[model samples]
Target: MQDHTVISSLIVRVLPDHGESAAARLASIEGVEVHEKLEGKIVVTIEAPTVDSSHDTAASFSEIPGVIGVDLVYVNFEDDPAVAKGSQR
Candidate 1:
């Protein structure tokens, strides 16, 4: 088996079904970390054991009432075959 990992960061710009309260609600999800807040958006970072987890976290954010959309600002992974694929030395 191969290990798959991913790090995802999203800038959620909320139209806010309930203003800051909406943002607050989204911040409550597990494994989701709030990196910053500016204007009407919250920046969140999610680290998961796999790509699916990362996407699941994003979906959670989208389920929030105030969430207008999620802008993926950053994503990095360590499973690329070219860089560290077999560098086990």
Candidate 2:
């Protein structure tokens, strides 16, 4: 196995909806990057050193006025047993 550090990412769908400009601004944040953005829902992916960094990025998204909610869908090298097995299988 290769020695690698786990990099967690947060997939966020911006809520309350807003303009493409605002979403662009959100994506422009230092560590945040936009993976996809359609309509009022913007999918953002943030990679950080630790889970806390992921959570911190999520919290930053919530700070955006139009943002309604933040959801974390995946993390680096997901720790789920089923997922791990599925990857191998």
Strongest candidate by lDDT: 1
lDDT of 1 at 31: 66
lDDT of model 1, residue 37: 78
Ten contiguous residues minimizing lDDT sum, candidate 2: 1-10
Candidate 2 residue-wise lDDT, 1-89, digit = tens:
33323344454454444646658777788667777777667776665545555566678777776676676766674643444667797
**What is the clash tally of candidate 1?**
0
TM-score of 1: 0.73
Clashes of 2: 0
lDDT of residue 47 for candidate 2: 58
Measured against the true structure, the TM-scores of the candidates, in listed sequence, are 0.73, 0.64
